[model samples]
Target: MRSLPLTPSRPVTAASDGRPALPPQHLADLDLGQRQTLLAGLGQPAYRAKQISTHYFGRLTRDPQAMTDLPAAVRAGVAERLLPTLLTPVREDACDSGATRKALWRLHDGALVESVLMGYPDRVTVCVSSQAGCGMACPFCATGQAGLTRNLSTAEIIDQVVHLAGVAAAGGVTGSPPRLSHVVFMGMGEPLANYGRVIAAVRRLCAPPPEGLGLSQRHVTVSTVGLVPAMRRLAGEDLSVTLALSLHAPDDDLRDELVPVNQRWKVAEVLDAAWEYADRTGRRVSIEYAMIRDVNDQPWRADLLGRLLAGRMAHVNLIPLNPTPGSRWDASPKPIEREFVRRLRTAGVAVTVRDTRGREIDGACGQLVAAETAS
Candidate 1:
């Protein structure tokens, strides 16, 4: 995998916005009437909030020049204050013939986060980072290995999708979808760890146009490594986002080794929380298993996993472990992977292998940022 610059850097301080960054309160960050209050404080009428919202979310334009509905006098002030930029593009690399593209962004505080946009025949999905880096120290995960930099603000998380939606609108993807239809929080950070901001960002993303992106709540997926309390808390949001449990293994012995959080919550506790969420939201949970060779891929572990998930309102997404540089972990062999799937199916669990995208572009979560930091 090689690095490609998406745009030229303007100027950045050592803190990386290259300039004094404003406090994080972009228009995207606010709730419904909050923008009106912001504009009213600026001595502008309340209706200006709707105009700014329409410009950002409806037309997907960040340029003041493109916001013709607003007076020229207030455009700069409105953009500078209400819609200040949160993420600066460092670079982006595309793979899968431009269908799978990964972007590395530099946050105002110099924390780097990554997002991946994958175009399919039916839908366009963008995997966004909820935090700059990850705190969950999963040994096999590159982001986890790096440790946490900072939790991304609601605007920061929202920025990833808004920017990519503009890209898609410009026909940046191979299949040529002009709008984002699905989003997944399977990027750099443990989403539940940054609970409040992540939840706010979810609301902002699912809110109808002129308020948020207006995507279906069902199309959104938030992944976690089984933060038990947070999982239970999320079920109460009535957001209806599909909860994906990053359950790399079944038994506590192996899981505690693979997913460090399992040491605290244990495998059973996590699964129970996931089932409770499914019951509450009427949404099927997604179990994420990264098959690693000779580690958690043993036949007995597969059987144990199947037994744990058997007859649950869930589907197992078998991820062929994307090998990280200098890491001992690697994807399971084809025969072994198939056997793992077979065991789950025999146990009456629905299963499918994840499409391994952006391999050539460091598409795996945190791979691109890790490479950047190392350099």
Candidate 2:
């Protein structure tokens, strides 16, 4: 008998021709203002370092000359050391009339994750990754199939947003500095699995101008696949970021197959945990249900889901599953999807279908990186 072909095991950040991987040092791993102190030790003043950081973090400036306040001799050294490159884009694919762009980034460590920039009429939302690869083993997710690599440091995660904000700021998109109006941690990995760093990243993200990214906590959303302990742990944090649970199925039997973690924490445990979070935070919980063609999309499941969420302050985001190449699962048909929405609404549940952006460009959670793994 022949052995099964191994799924690609290498990180997705390798050079296109498969060269040695680069190592990325995360800024968050460093102490507060340490990057500045490092420069100060090298003959630059503390305030000069702050100026450089202001350009990078506040103004979203990547270019060194943009820091005009700095002396000519020392600016190069500051840029060389403090601005050590983090992620270099391996490939960028765009669909949806340039409104949706997916980028496969190669971190210095060769670890790979993805981020998506989506332009809507009202707001521009960036979907960012919290971990390099995922460990949750959700069968429908490409990253879950790859397994976990490591939790991205706070800076590694924020670099993605800052990079995009830099681009948008440079191009002058909408708001005065082309601010990122919204952020979602729904891209590559199980966010709560990497709780500590994720929380740190959230702080750095929601921090006001000059000190941090300046995005509002209300505009940020963090998602998880029902890590019960972590969810409860997060509720205690005082941060106002939205919490989204990938509760693909309402019952344990089906959920165990859809999201294997259900075997560890059953449906009741997860919902109880979610309700605890909502009660604690006074924020509505968002339940994410991916509608698979014949699996987990039944009317009975829809009503069950509504019953499960009925009296709670909750919102449902129904995703039409974006089929991966050769995967047995596919998105639900139109009529079934509409009926599912109708039944939920009839039950007085608030729900909406995800716009399904970037479908043409492997827009499902982890398809682009998965394809890179396959190649």
Candidate 3:
């Protein structure tokens, strides 16, 4: 009956809290000039950046042994100095008969993050974590429960995409190759909270071959719980990736409790920021609302949400709360869910239920917190 208690959280930058980055030599962590500088220091030609980037980003192969194009003598040196191994898979779980696979990665410091790969008919999507855990204390989110570990380096974030891209290219699970088409930052961390590296990582993902992995900027998405300044900053980046604002509740009173960051930047402010993102990128912003039973799912709230989103150049993704183990929150009942959908439609707001994947696998972002603790 009383409002849920607020939990403390803060925005994380690229190690702005004094968290260390991935080792300096990590190539994906380095910029173009930095990579070239590292290469020159190794007594290798600057042009090797292209060859190395070709092998790593374009081909998605991390093993130096596989790059016969590089002179065998320098391959090890290039890899050693610029591309030290970042993630080692700790466990891999698959469901939907392998159409969906979740990987738990152990970072160099033994910090763990999770990424999910889902294959649909025409394309594959990888959900990557931008931080090791998460700092935003959204009460219903599993990642929010685990708290912040650290912001992932650009390389660590890219590694998730690279590994999954490799999977798609090789027909690893489906037995027929498909290009990895979509990337969502809806995995573990508060993406905008870690703004610098996240934007840099986006650049690396969208840059042309030999400089980046060359994925189209349009296919990528960055999500946040309304970090206002960073959202404004992102609008000016000239990158066209979709911005997903996790607006779990319509009113600031509820949102302040649900998405704690909403305490600092309330609902209207966040929505205004989302609109600016749409205006700048010419991309429809994505509004993500998680439906929690009897908590934020009342019909009146749906109407409130509809009014808020009615004509915005945005799409609503309604997520049936992936109830964490032993948690008080649960998904809205089926009929309630439908009625909620109907209310939004009545208001002419476009909305769709996001497919609830990887729940049984504890692959919903930091949902692995419960699973890893049990193990």
Candidate 4:
């Protein structure tokens, strides 16, 4: 196993053209126009772009041999240039009777990232990473501890969804629908930090087939650790994806410690941006709070959180903290969690505890990658 630098040696910057250089350009990385132009340069007609897109986005198969409609002579070269392998699976773990599975992947540069596919009775959702590790530095998060590696390219992010979608379609997940219908950017990194690529990936995910994946935009969710500017920018993108604000703490003092980004954006500013997103998109913002044992689960804090979100276009998702290895943090006790929920409900805030999945398998975002790299 190759080890990756947990923290970037230098400050991370987006490529001048907003694409990462390490992973070779992929068809998913390009828009339809660029795809057409590339094929033209290869002496293939422009329509080959759409033909290839149908195989990838519509059929969810990237094997050149499976694209039988294309001329055999051109298949391998086209696949090499446009659908270069990006995520090589390192390890996969499953729990909840195989309904929830997590996969660790190695990028071209040896940086490790993870994505999770969860199957429910009615729908399937895949949580994907936007960056290899995270820069947020949230004390209780495994990914945050790993620190920033680099932003995943647009295709790197999208491929996770496409791959997982194929798994779901093939009935890899037990007792769940055979199709993937939802996506969440709540995996290994602070999604908004890798702003451009994440947004581009969302666009590709939602665009109709032959151009992109054709998933409904409303079914996708993008999470942020309160990057105020990026949150606000996402609102104007004409997208309606759910905005999940990982507001682990309601008060500034605790939040500054729990979510280090709070020190820069502050709780008030972050909530304001979330509200702005809700207003513009007409989609209720999801306020995500991790219930840590005696950390941010007190009744007072719940009430405070309720006060902030009450009567607003928001819903609180209380996540039971999935303690990382050697981390002091632990999930709030059931009684404490119940009390917290009661307070929020009393304050007229709609709230639900997120179903804890894949816990036995180090299901938290960065744990599997961390373990793989360590081994």
Candidate 5:
């Protein structure tokens, strides 16, 4: 495993924005029954809670007026308590026949982050951000290059879903409400760094409607660049959400360069943690390998990756490096990508190339955040 050079000082501080770090809190942020009790305390009947919930979770409606069944007076308070606005859309860019949209959001603190809403024929998946930027400096990532601003609160993370779910429900191009069937923590930040909030948000996402958004836990996938201790911690949390390890390279040497955190937790250690989680949860771990041209996309590396993942209950998702503007890295050539997948399959390892999404809109994972920062 490669070692990350330790930096001596923190260049950024909470005071950079001149505001106290506001803890994240939102209506969906509450436990379902707690939300009901809060509404009940406001003089609404107990059943009205369900009605209001249907508007938000079931219908994906945030507009109070659209909740026609509720009394007018109750709408304002309900919106205030349960639907407090979390993210203001700073800019939205769409492509792929309007099926893919990348939204740059401004958080309450003026921190910028992004989420991608991609609509496919079978499923509509939202790739959401967990932190404003990333703390784990992987060097190649645009967000990592900028360094982390702060961890996103649970509500701020969930707001991305609520907003995108609303967008999908509106059906911009897909005649019917696009079913938001999948979610990926592959957006602007490293989720595990914002450990507490990310875990809470997962529960909120999976909880049945009115209590939470009612998305199935299995549909959610959280990715990390091998934070071993955190992975172990997540294993014990009883969450069955899919764990995705950004194992960019097979061994520590290349991994250290690709994912700097590998210096702290080597490849073997990270895989052990992932295997343990798989054994415990009966969920297959997703190993995300971004194939960078001539860098880590070698055929031998592909063979090694297949061998490492061979018998474990795991799947390899090969992503062609979505090269960001001015970034030195580039995607592996098509022939190389095909051969890489072929080698993994030869080793009897399950693998698939990730369908490149949102390319026209600076879709490389952290590009939108970098753009926001530049603007």
Candidate 6:
């Protein structure tokens, strides 16, 4: 087995990628005990940790003014130290009668990333980025094409969830539940590439009140472009969050181009790790395949995919390729897409075409950020 690379638990003062390091530590970066320790060092009572946590996590407000429970003298200090602004909303575009919203955020260092909020009658879901940009180099993906800036700190990742959750609770998503219930790490980066921070963020997001936003672990979905080592490690962590494998193509030959990581870990190896994850967690794996026109959407590939997943605890999420600007890729036609679904079903593999939400507003993963950067 290839040894996994070490990922830092806290942001460094500088990044090797020529991008600035992540912002200072935020409350979401620390566990309950760490929070207490931090407050004690600042000459504040340890119990103040819980009080501030209640205001931030439970109330979902980062404004020190909104945290009236804290003494005025301490509020400013605590807020400046632990609640420094991390994400500045640069732009937000809404569609689907306001059921779908995509937000472009400028990080403290001016590196931009995006998150999306989508609401249905039953639930509200937020898709968040794990990195400012992506290193995967999946030719058709906007973020991948732009390349990596830096890994987001654990707090940076969690802040996206908390902020969007607050928006949902305020009825920002039309005709839907007024609370955010689901989270997907599918916005800009290859999540597992920033393994340590992503795992920390997940734990913080799912922990109960005063510690986290109190979300169910099962409601969180983390997508990867087949980071085999990270997938195996995640299974051992005992987390039950859904694991989504971005297996854009069923065959290694085509996948090598669509998802360059395939060159390192072949299709069979990646799927084996995914199956192991499913077996250990008892959570069905999600196979994410992007249907690119005249690319990997051939009928034979669909049959091959079905054969590979037959009888496995997996579901195929067929994504119609959302074309990035100046990209040669395009979504498969309706007939081609329907036939792909049919083949998977005929082979007894569960499949569904992903809803193309926010298509008009540059909805696919990094589209919004890409446009912002270009401008």
Question: Ten residues in a row with the worst lDDT in model 3?
Answer: 1-10
Instruction: Give every collision pair in model 5.
Output: 1-252
Better of 4 and 5 by lDDT: 4
lDDT tens readout by residue for model 2, 129-151: 98888989888888888888777
Best candidate per TM-score, number? Answer: 1
Q: TM-scores of the models, in the given order?
A: 0.95, 0.89, 0.91, 0.94, 0.90, 0.94
Tell me the tens digit of each residue's lDDT in model 6 across 210-314: 999889999999999998999999999989999999999988889998899999999999999999999999999999999999998899999999999999999
lDDT of each: 0.88, 0.81, 0.84, 0.89, 0.83, 0.89
- Per-residue lDDT of candidate 3, residues 1-375 (tens digit): 111232222222235566654443477887777888888988889888877888888888888878898898887887688777777776677777667888777777667788988888777888999998889988888889888988888888998899888977887556334778788998889998788888889999888877888888999989999999999999998899999999989998899899999989999999999999898888999999998999889999999999999988989999988888788999999899999999999999999999877766875677665576567
> How far out, in Å, is residue 324 in model 2?
0.4
Error of 1 at 345 (Å): 0.6
Question: Can you tell me which runs of candidate 2 are displaced by over 4 Å?
Answer: 1-36, 172-177
Ten consecutive residues with minimal summed lDDT in candidate 2? 1-10
Model 5 bad stretches (over 4 Å):
1-18, 21-24, 40-43, 173-177
TM-score of 5: 0.90
Cα lDDT, model 3, residue 325: 79
Worst 10 residues of 1 by lDDT: 8-17
Tens-digit lDDT string for candidate 1 (199-315): 998899889979999989999999999999999999998889999999998888888888999989998889999999999999999999999999989999889888888888999
Cα lDDT, model 3, residue 67: 87
Please rank every candidate by TM-score, starting with the best.
1, 6, 4, 3, 5, 2
lDDT for 175 (candidate 3): 35
Q: Which candidate would rank higher by lDDT, 2 or 4?
A: 4
| lDDT value, candidate 6, whole model | 0.89
Candidate 6 clash pair list: none
Give me candidate 4's TM-score against the actual structure: 0.94
* Candidate 6 backbone overlaps, count: 0
Residue pair clashes in candidate 2: 22-108, 23-108, 24-108, 24-109
